[model samples]
Target: MSIHLVTGAGSGIGAAVARRLLERGDELWLLARDAGRAKALAAGFPGARTLVGDLAEPSRLSWALGHQAPPDRLDSLLHIAGVVELGDIGDLTPKVWNETLAVNLVGPAELTRLFLPQLRLSRGHVVFVNSGAGLDAHAQWGPYAASKHGLKALADALRREEHPGGLRVTSVFPGRTATPMQAKVHQQEGKRYDAERWIAPESVATTVLTAIDLPQDAEITDLTVRPGR
Candidate 1:
């Protein structure tokens, strides 16, 4: 069975992806921000392993992961954890921009760098669960969009640089999914929240799995998932 280290496995697309991986007998590692969250994820995913690393503080990630015992054979590293606080560019503060970039972009970059040896050893995939904002920025999405846009660049550069080594990199841009994050976005937008109106987290999970499961002879560099209905 392939092994994977997943971030944001507590809920939404990350949870869906973790569940699917566990159901299929893959060795799964869930990255939790704290001991309490790690315990919770361990309880939620019975056979899966848990690692403590706070993505919000990217600078401390190396030290944190160093203390934890991560998987030795990693087939993929799934970057799905993210936070958002919607505000117009003019109204947003430096703290907002810093925190958003720290969690969404810098954290993922550091985590990937730390795991590069293992990933290179296995020719593994690195999947970034980015948002449509990565492609197009809109009002009140400055910080989040900027971070995702940087993520796209990260994935692109990594793919090109690692191509000779057979490492795969994919950026999955999912449109408003029915996630707690999406609900919060709606709240920030002062709009009605309807789970049915957005893409299901499971659908995005499927897209992620498909990208990772693709044959070694081919690669899906980028994928976009939008709501069907």
Candidate 2:
């Protein structure tokens, strides 16, 4: 059976992806910060495994990667854990800036590094859940935008470097998905951002599954999924 590891598997797109993969008869390992949430999610799936650790912590992530019976090869690594901090330049603080970068860019980068061996062993694929902000900058989204931009560049560079080894890397940019993150951003703005009109997390999850299911000889490279007006 194909073994897929997904971060941020406790909710939203991650949860949907986990369920979809399970339905397809794939073994899934979900990583999340909240043990309770992870357990709850795992319970919903008969054989799925859940690991609790903060991806932002290098030591914890390293331990999780090392101790796990390194899958003969990981079929896919979905780096989906991320955070968005919305604020103007004046409202930005060091803590908020660093937290956003840590979760959105640094953690994924570090996790990829630690899992490179397993990925190479399986010649597996890596998928990044990026955002539209990664492609275009908007006012008051400086930190979030910058982090996603870095993530996009990182994914591209990794893809190029690993192509010879058969490891495919894809960065997906989804525009305004109706996930908890969107709710948080909307709350910060004190208004809804056309929530009903936005794309659903399930749609984004389908895009991710598509990227993973592509033929080994092909790579999706970069894909952008957006809601139609």
Candidate 3:
């Protein structure tokens, strides 16, 4: 069975993706900001490992994972942890902008770097759960959009750097998924949260699994899944 590591395993899309991986009989190592939540989720699976820490500080995450006696063979790294704080460019605070970049971009980038040796041993795939904001900016979504755009650039650079080493990298751009984050966005917009109006997290997970299951000779570099209005 392949070994997978997933960040942001507490809830929403991250949780959904972890469940799907478990169902496929692959071993999972989950990381979340709350260790207790990750432990609770791990209890449901037979042999799952959970790490508790904030992604904003990748060094802490590295220390925690190192203590886990990480498996030598890692088949995939799924970077699903993210934060979205919206504000127009003019109104975005320095603190918010810094936190956004740290959590959404730097954290993932650093995690991948720390795990690169293990991943290279197995020729593993790296998947980044990006958003539509990475593609086009919205009026008041400046901070979030900037972080995602940087994520897109990071993914592209990694793909170019690692393809020669047999590593596959994918960036998934999902549009307005019906997640807790989406609920928060709705609150900001003064609109009722309608689950049907957005894409389902499970659907996105399915796409990720499909990409991972592709023939070793083939790679799906980028995928965009959007809601059908």
Candidate 4:
């Protein structure tokens, strides 16, 4: 069975993706800020492992994942953890910007780097769960948009650097989804939080699984999933 590592496994898209992978009997290593939630989610999968820590701080990753032995190869790496803070440029503070970047961009970059050796051995796929904001910034999405933009750049660079080695890198840019983060965004925008108006996390997970299931010789470099208009 293929082995995958998924971050942000506590809820929303991350959890959905993790569940899908486990359903297929693929082994999973999940990382989340909520240890209890992670453990609970992995309870049904005997091959699943969970780690708890702030992924934004890469220094804590070692300790968080220390309980399990390092794998000789990793089939996939899914960077799904992210933080969103809504505010216009003038209203946003440096702390908000820093936190956003740390969680969305820097942390994933380091985690990918750390897993490179194993990935290289398996010629694995790396997928980043980006947002539509990464393509165009909205009035109050400065910090989050900037971080996603940076994440896009990171994915691009990784694809270029690893393509020759048979490592596939994909960036999945999805529009607003029915997630807790989207609820917060809607609240800040003074808009009603309507789940029907957004894409389902399961839909995004389906897209991700599609990318992972593609022929080994083919690569889906970029994927964009949005709600039907």
Candidate 5:
């Protein structure tokens, strides 16, 4: 069974991906923000392991992971945890921008760095769960979109650098998924939250699984998922 480390596994797309992996008997490692969240995730996933590290504080992830026992043979690293705050660029503060970049971009970069040895050994794949806003920024999505756009850059550069080392990197840009983040987005936008109108988290999970499960002959560099309804 291949082992995988996943972030943002508490809910929505992350949770869906975690569940599907577990159901298939893949070894799972979950990254939680704190001790309490780690404990809760352990309970929720039964056999899965948990590591405590806050993505909001990217600099400390090294110290945090140094204190814990991470998986030594990871087949995949799933960067799925993210945070979003909607506001006009003028109203967004430095704190907001820093926190968004820390969680969405820098943290993933650091995590990938720390896990590179194990991943390289296994020829693992790295999947970034990005947003469509990474490609097109809307009025109130300044910071979040900026972070995601940086994520796309990270994925592209990593893919080029690691290609000879047998590493696969894929960016999945999903649009308007029915997630808790989406609900909050709608609330911030002063609109009704309708789950049915958005893409299902499970649908995105399927895309992720397909990318990793593809034969070693080729790689899926980027994927975009949108709501059909």
Candidate 6:
């Protein structure tokens, strides 16, 4: 069985992906900021491990990855943890911009870099759970949109760099998923956002698993999953 590591495993797409991996009989390592939530979610799985820390913290990420006995060189690393903050351009602050970029781009990139040796050894795949915002722009989503755009570029560039080394990368751009993040956006906008009718966390998880299962010779460079009208 292959070993998989997933970030943002406390809830939403991250939780769904962890469950899917467990159901497939793969060993799973769940990284989340909440110790209780991570432990609770990992309770039922036989080979699941939970690491609690903020992904935005470089030292925490390093400690989590190296503190424990490393699992048999991960077969897959899913960068599913992210932060979404909605606000008009006028509302943008240094703190908001920094936090958004830290969780959505910097942290994921640093974590991937730290794990490159293990990934190269296994010839594994890296999946970035990006958003439609990464491809297109939306009003009042300045920080989130910019961060995702940066992440998309990072994923594409990494894929190109690792192609000859047998590493595959996929950027999964999902639109308006039904999650707490969506609720936060709607609340911030003070209006109803109907895009929620299309994307579900489980559906995104399925797409992610499909990308993970593809043959090494084939690659789905970027995937866009949107809700159909």
RMSD of 6: 1.9
- The true-versus-predicted C-alpha distance at residue 173 of model 2, in Å, is 0.4
Query: lDDT (CA) for every model shown?
Result: 0.95, 0.86, 0.87, 0.87, 0.96, 0.86
Candidate 3 off by > 4 Å: 44-46
Q: After superposition on all CA atoms, what RMSD does each candidate show versus the true structure?
A: 0.6, 1.7, 1.5, 1.8, 0.5, 1.9
Q: Give, for candidate 6, the lowest lDDT window spanning 10 residues.
A: 63-72
For model 6, what is the C-alpha lDDT against the true structure? 0.86
Per-residue lDDT value at 158 in model 1: 99
Residue 159, candidate 1: Cα error in Å is 0.4
Candidate 1, residues 56-105, lDDT tens digits: the string is 89899999988877778789999999999999888999999999999999
TM-score of each: 0.99, 0.93, 0.95, 0.93, 0.99, 0.92
lDDT per residue (tens digit) for residues 31-81 in model 6 = 766667666757755579876657667557777767666565988999998
lDDT of 5 by residue, 23-82 (tens): 999999999999999999999999999999999998999999999899888999999999
Of the two candidates 3 and 5, the one with more favorable TM-score, higher being better, is 5
Model 4 lDDT tens row, 102-216:
8998889878887899999999999999999989998888999999999999999999999999999999999989899889888888989998899999999999999998999
Off by over 4 Å in 4: 34-37, 44-47, 62-68
Q: Which candidate leads in lDDT? A: 5
Q: In each prediction, how many residue pairs overlap at the backbone (N, C-alpha, C within less than 3 A)?
A: 0, 0, 0, 0, 0, 0
TM-score of 6: 0.92
- After superposition, candidate 2 runs with Cα above 4 Å error: 64-72
Model 4 residue 8 lDDT score: 78
